[model samples]
Target: MYYQCVKLRQIIIAVYLSISLDGVADSSGPYLASGIKIGEVDQTSAIVWVRLTHEKRAHFDKLPILTKGLKRNEKDAESMPEGVARGMAGEVRVGYVATNEKRAFAWTDWTQVLAENDFTHQFKLADLKSGASYSCIVQVREVGSDKLSSTTNGSFKTAPKKTQPVPIRFIVTTCQSVRSIDSGAQGHVAYKTMLELDPHFFVHTGDILYYDKAPLCKNIKQARAKWNLIFAYEHNMNFHRQVSSYFMKDDHDTLKNDCWPGQTYGDLTFDQGLKIFREQVPMGKKTYRTIRWGKHVQIWLTEHRDFRTSNRVEDGPEKTILGMEQKAWLMRTMKQSDATHKFLIVPGPIVGPDKRGKNDNHSNKGFSNEGQQLRNFLAKQKNTYVICGDRHWQYCSKDPQTGVLEMGCGPVNDQHMFGGAPKADKTYHRFFGKKGGFLAVTVVDGKAKAEWMSADVKGNTGKPEIRYTELLGSR
Candidate 1:
């Protein structure tokens, strides 16, 4: 009887989905490159992202012609011209509603068409109630037609108000290499577990997509193609549909290994890479910013690639990783924040000693002077911690000198490549092998507890074990 009931429910859900899709389009070619996703949610606002494909043939002929003469190597290039040919132009709008109840949906006015044709549309939905869940629908229509050509649905929850005593829970993860996805792995197991856990939000530390490495993306067209393929994956789409996410880029996703601004490789320049990164990801104008989850948790998201000095430069007090402006912003934010728990999310490990020595320029040891300064500042602050990714293993450690705990969340689906065995870091209290998983953090009052959940190579995650528990602030 129980099995029969479950089967009937599944059938009903399938029919409902079919009906919902039926209104969007008739017999036509694909209209959406990627479905809707929610990015960068806060107490009263959120960003909705959608990518639209051309409904008919592309409008490349409308583009202005290039007047400059091409270099010998560039003359043979066909990809850039092809990319221009694929451009589309049309109108798109998003309608959204916020409610505490599941069935009660009262959609607000349709937003202006923010983007058109082979482009990403990021619609900012503001003036929402704090800590409320919202459901949204995106619809695309031709320039003159009143009928909608495409529609997709997604949902997200706003952060809690500053005065609210809401308990905060979130998941942290990183490193989804495209190689893993292409190897015929069914779907990421860790993502499946995350959906079941259903945290308030998800944090991707960095390496969101690997473009610089094997099966390298050499041009803008190739980079965009990679982005499309990554987003089209079932696991990624399913995860983003239900949970709001914060994203940052690391070396592999940007340009090359240990990449920084001004570095050029093949046909991909840093500017081009940056452009694609910003367009594909749901981020604001500035990459490094802060998100407050009521009075209990404050997260500082940092950008590691844009302003840093080249890794080849000699190490000194002048050598920096976060760069000058971002470093200053981080310090000021940390000092001024009154949240019970302050989290500084970096793209690489900030506390542990990397076994690779100076080659690990992004790690703390390579930028020791700046790292020490930041650590000293954090030491004086109450209830501060550092959460990092880029390392392939999980570790819970405290800086011996500053007593700031740094928790490393392992790769999401990529093969664990480094930091498997416990290195000789005296500050490290717990270490897990090269297994892909994420960190689940729970905060109550001024205290926070973290659980390091482990998953196998195939993405099968096991039970989450308590890794660290402590008072966030000095009482």
Candidate 2:
């Protein structure tokens, strides 16, 4: 949606001019990866990221140094050369590690760390002057000549330094299929509409990349088709050459749906599967980490399937989800937060189905078992809320015991609908039945007014298929 006010018009114009020149994916130039992405701008830092076009970075590294001696375009020197080539690499090379050294935020101090376990690359920049609007880009190296070819470039504004609620946005997505996007009805149009929202942040609840090794979605070919859904978008000629994007990987994003340590989809061993993920997405290495927006909101994002021992917990105390290290990290972070609101990016279920009975869901790591532990532990702490996705509809209800609100959002584009969802006009908030949708949340004056917005009708554009919003007052 590229929403910007008159005041931001200059920034937009400037960013586009730089990008148009550097991002030329279709015509043999350096290029940026595409599809759903995320960027974080803070008062002192800004993080920009994107997936790569291949498994390695060969000649890309050489392109940059070769062009170093050449006089850069003076008007937009930082963006000139690089912006002109994004997503234009006709062939794959060494592990995609190319990054632009000039442009808006060229000197803003960026890090390009590969998520060795997956196809994601995370660029975390720190010490950015607070409140300053800056630009950024990626460049490829022309081996041995010191010549550099520029690709991706765009502008972003950092959050304020004040200890108050600040604007933070990024796009979030998961569960994309390759075949559907290319040949299906909506196709790339989905992203076209989402970008209009211009959210402050994006949080994809896993499935960022899927190969469908589990046959969970039905068939092997279908699984391959699913991978095409999201990966194909990021690889699209138009998107890579033009649009900017960020990506994160999940089970499906890595292999098959609801996949984990218990199974392997195809030829990918856990390590090999991680490499595939590392090759395609742009994500920080830390699977579980904290993103703080001012001193008001704290987001604890984690990957549940990555470091678990099968899905079953055997009370051996040795079994873990985040692993001992990540678990301790989460616990420590939770106890240390002083934000007005704490958001846990729980990718799976929280109030899961019971497991003790005959119809019990087995395993220690099962949603009902692990999820319950997490929920109860948080309840013991000061104050926090739970919001998750995976199910295709939206459900909002409060924990009868602690009076905390639990919200569910999902299936932005789905093949099914909810059946007999508990209907609650007001308090018992529930929206849609077998549909595709997303979530919209706004935190104002310490109170967050959020909703499950979906597109009940296929023809709907830019707006949700359906929407239901509720307030979760600040703790």
Please list the residue runs of candidate 2 whose C-alpha ends up more than 4 Å from where it truly belongs after superposition.
6-15, 18-43, 50-124, 140-150, 157-162, 167-174, 179-188, 213-248, 312-319, 352-369, 381-383, 416-433, 455-466
Per-residue alpha-carbon lDDT of candidate 2 for residues 1-475, written as tens digits (9 for 90 to 100): 2455323634554655575445333332223333223243445654444443332222222223212222112111121122111232221121111122233333422223232312234456666655445544454432222334334444445554447666544333334432223223224344544545555455667654335422133333333223323433332322322223333455655555545664665444555555554444444555566776665567777766678665533544565555667777887888988877777766654552212321111112343444455666777665477666554455665655445555665544543232223334343333333444566666656666666654332464535443566665643
The clash tally of candidate 1 reads: 2
Clashing residue pairs, backbone N/CA/C < 3 A, model 1: 88-117, 383-472
TM-score of 1: 0.82
What's model 1's lDDT at 460? 44
Q: Give the clash count for each candidate.
A: 2, 100
Give the whole-model CA lDDT for all candidates, comma-separated: 0.67, 0.46
Highest TM-score, which number? 1
Q: What does the lDDT read for residue 39 in candidate 1?
A: 87
